[model samples]
Target: MEFDGKTFLTALGLAFILEGLPYFLLAERMPTVLRFLSERPAPELRRLGLTAILAGLAVVALVRW
Candidate 1:
């Protein structure tokens, strides 16, 4: 329950790396991938976002437990 600044920052930095890797590694395909995502309906995007959040939470819970 206590705040740990270093651990928090490390996790945040890892998240940034994970989020940026696809765009950095797939420089060419990113435009097409982004175009496909842009065309998705709002509800669909919301569902996908929720699914990702839940999955990420599950992993974090397992790791921290």
Candidate 2:
């Protein structure tokens, strides 16, 4: 699938909206979540981030295919 500038921007905007929704709705719980994340080991956080990236890539690949 080929991407155009507009499509890329739209996807980025949508991602931003989805990412922000939790913080917007759960403003009170954000600090607790942040604290929990802060306490996690760096390696664990790195693995978690890598997993998220892989999951996102899988979804995008499926959708694009």
RMSD to the true structure for each prediction, in A, is 0.8, 1.5
The lDDT for every candidate, in the order shown, is: 0.98, 0.96
lDDT of 2: 0.96
What is the alpha-carbon RMSD of candidate 2 to the true structure? 1.5
* Predicted candidate 1 versus true structure: per-residue lDDT over 1-65, tens digit per residue: 89999999999999999999999999999999999999999999999999999999999999989
Question: RMSD of model 1, in Å?
Answer: 0.8
Q: For candidate 1, report its TM-score.
A: 0.93
lDDT of 2 by residue, 3-58 (tens): 69998899999999999998999999999999999999999999999999999999
The global Cα lDDT (0 to 1) of model 1 is 0.98
Please tell me which predicted candidate would have the highest TM-score against the true structure: 1
> Which residue runs does candidate 1 get wrong by more than 4 Å?
none
Worst 10 residues of 1 by lDDT: 55-64
